[model samples]
Target: MADNYKQYTSCCQAKDWVSLSAYLGFAAAGLAVVWIPIIALAGWCALFYLLVAAAAAGVAACRWWLEVRLVCLGGDRSAIGMLVSSEPPADKSWPGSVDSDFSMNLLPYPALPGIKQADLELTSPYGFLVAEQAGTKQHVGFFTGEKATEKNGVESAILHAEFEGAGVRDVLIAVTVALGLAIAALIACVAIPPPWGLIVAGILALLAFLAALFGTLFGSGDHGAPGDVKGAPTEVHDNDPVTGLGADLLYVYGTWVFDSLHTGWNEIHPIKKCTFVGKWEGAWPADIVDVQHRLDAGFADARDPATVSRQAEDRFTWAIHPLVDGCGEAVDVPAPAQADAGLH
Candidate 1:
């Protein structure tokens, strides 16, 4: 997240109270922890430095969520594209929160000029070994971007996953806090009425000073502040074979968003489940089939509607279905505008 925390809250749109509250919480906590030394060390003069330190802490917490690496989301859109290669694993540039991160290049349908199938970044948050069994290998399935739609103005297909804050932000936090604590500790040696008062201040200041020092070394946990980000490992196996193919395609049963604030790529973050629909041959028929619709007025689930491979795109191991194209036949495209007139 940027200094303003916009990267974290971009997907949230106007509903950013969660992030705001976190910022305030961290700042208040930092201030409260060292308030005694804050006054004992520099009288009222140190308030300015303390405020600055708190602000830095607040910004870090808002960005990293105490190193929790929670991904906020937004929007929902379906895309049909070809999975070029298969069985890719998480790269070196992955955040600690991501586990068994599987990604493959996708050439999104309604294919953009230069854009490939786009990156289908999947994670094994549950229990799905996608790198081995997502059927994610070389298939043209209907993928629903849980929180993103536009192929991107940049035309980049890599799924967005990095937080800008986790980078230089750590350096900033470490340097700021260390400097502030050091100054306060040094001042405590000279000021603070000597003897017992000075002793207490020295002890407190040393503990705080040491904390600031070790915190940078230990890492960011309390809101991902002043250190590198790391997380526990997780796995992926086929427990729910629905989300990996992409959720929010036919029916959006959850809140999903593009999460443009951090990384501006369309991603399914924690993939729910995925099934191997079929291999991607070539371009799908522009009019493949609307198996889920074209039956009554529209907007209803259908089963095994595939008279052709294109129509077969709606195969969901679960009831949640997919976006199909009209191929090899004229679409039974029903009129939705007259849907109010009752099914014929």
Candidate 2:
């Protein structure tokens, strides 16, 4: 898990650097076109300053955005629910089933004051959260789940969304728009003359059209697939016991120990029903004997049976080591009798 996280971080950093480089290069080139001919040496110095400043700001923004996405998607389980509550309400019914369409406001973290309430549209059970916060309906994240939950005494459905490919798509769209505008401005600059202006405008128009075509092609990468990446678990499942285990386990990568861990599987209540939301990756396991074995191993290693019991009392809980993969397969090895002998 540590190695996988490090690799993912490195990949994200490399992507950020590449994006920053491209933006800075274009900005520098454009500034040079405008300022170089008028004031050569001075313009060069100014361009250097601009490049440094722009790069710093751009890279900073990129990193911040990445962090926000990570926190929103990965770190905090309740982030989506919190985000939903922060925004003003809209008159729309929650979809009867996960298969139906729905709309909701997506709010960014309180720290990100610049980010406005994003009006998100859910198309399918697994589609990106479309936000029009920046005056455009853009794909922001994947809709993970929604459940009725309380936040600061207010009752609402807590929505879960993950922003990975959606973030890349956002960057692509921003770059395309910026490039289109730059191309337009360049055409205008060339249109100061007569017959030459007509020729230049026609050529510029052709270039602009080609640029748009290329942008569309480039931006249309696969942003829909959720579980394509390894390590990042996209699926959620309810691993209810078929035998004598009294408590229900909401299993994703590991068994999710929620506050309602003591709730019976057949209980009909709002809290129990909303405690777990979203679709399972595949069919539920015929027997979670392997899962229980793995959990027992983990508990034995902890040397505190009480700690495992305490998890049920907590509002949120995750395993010290995830026992399952993205595909709902157990990955942890069961402890040997000798290892468990001393702990017991």
Candidate 3:
């Protein structure tokens, strides 16, 4: 399983998210470098100062840009948890597409220290988890307050991260626009008068901010080479789907990411597969899985605690808690190879 996950992780790598601000920053810097000297030499130091300021602001706003994480965790790994939510695949955000992704979230067994019942790690897989899902009352997952019989939606990270929205090329265009705006603002400052120059800069900032905001909310997304799903992760519920209270799941195969484009927390973005392991049961998580001895055997080898702590401080916390069977300190992911050592 680990080997397969590693290969899968390598194939999908961490998709990049180039925010509007980042592209603008690069453009602003480039423009400043080219024209700053000319402006200063022509006795337009005020314009130079304004241009520098504009460029600096454009760069600063991009602090939260680039949504892809440094280390994409969960390569060739399997985790057992509660199926707190399920986002059935659909053509979400993007129209005329073959569904963005079939996504879901997992709440690891042996809950982590200081963990809440609502914490859900993201996962995206296709096909079906159960034949019974068709007849469930869950048209939508647990996040919907009125329907989720368990009230788990009160606090959960549903619909957080899933590859969808502006692809890499789209991002490139966004970046180009950002740079163009920075340059436009710089040029406007040079031509416009005193207070008006600042006003023009302000207007440009507003425009950029608007664009960034739109992109932040909707523009932040993913692209995996070609023939990959695009758009935001869609949630689904059916077959009297687990509501209010959710069912348990043995989430197998997946990867994690930390990025600003989406919540900026580490999480399982593209889950390879998920298994429905019956409903939530028992004091210790073993009580839940023991219901299916076969499912229990899968987690029998190791626990997710080994790398959960090191991966996310608050988010992936549920994995670290000791299992009812006394989970050992088994490392979930093996060390990276020499050449790709620090790629994550």
Candidate closest to the true structure, highest lDDT: 3
Give candidate 1 misplaced runs (Cα > 4 Å): 1-11, 15-106, 110-113, 116-255, 260-267, 270-344
Clashes of 2: 0
Residue-by-residue lDDT tens digits, candidate 3, 213-257: 454344334322112323211222322233333354444444544
Winner on TM-score (1 vs 3): 3
lDDT of 1 by residue, 225-317 (tens): 111212211221211132223211111011233332232234433322222323333344444224212321221232224423444443422
What residue runs in model 3 are displaced by over 4 Å at the alpha carbon? 1-35, 41-64, 67-76, 85-105, 110-172, 181-244, 248-252, 257-266, 270-344
Better of 2 and 3 by lDDT: 3
Ranking by TM-score: 3, 1, 2
Better of 2 and 3 by TM-score: 3
- Give one digit per residue, the lDDT tens place, for model 2 in 106-183: 221211112211222232211232221221112221222233222323332222332223333344444454445444
Instruction: Give RMSD to native, each candidate.
Output: 19.3, 18.8, 18.9
Ranking by lDDT: 3, 1, 2
lDDT (C-alpha, whole model) for all candidates? 0.35, 0.30, 0.40
TM-scores of all predicted structures: 0.33, 0.28, 0.37
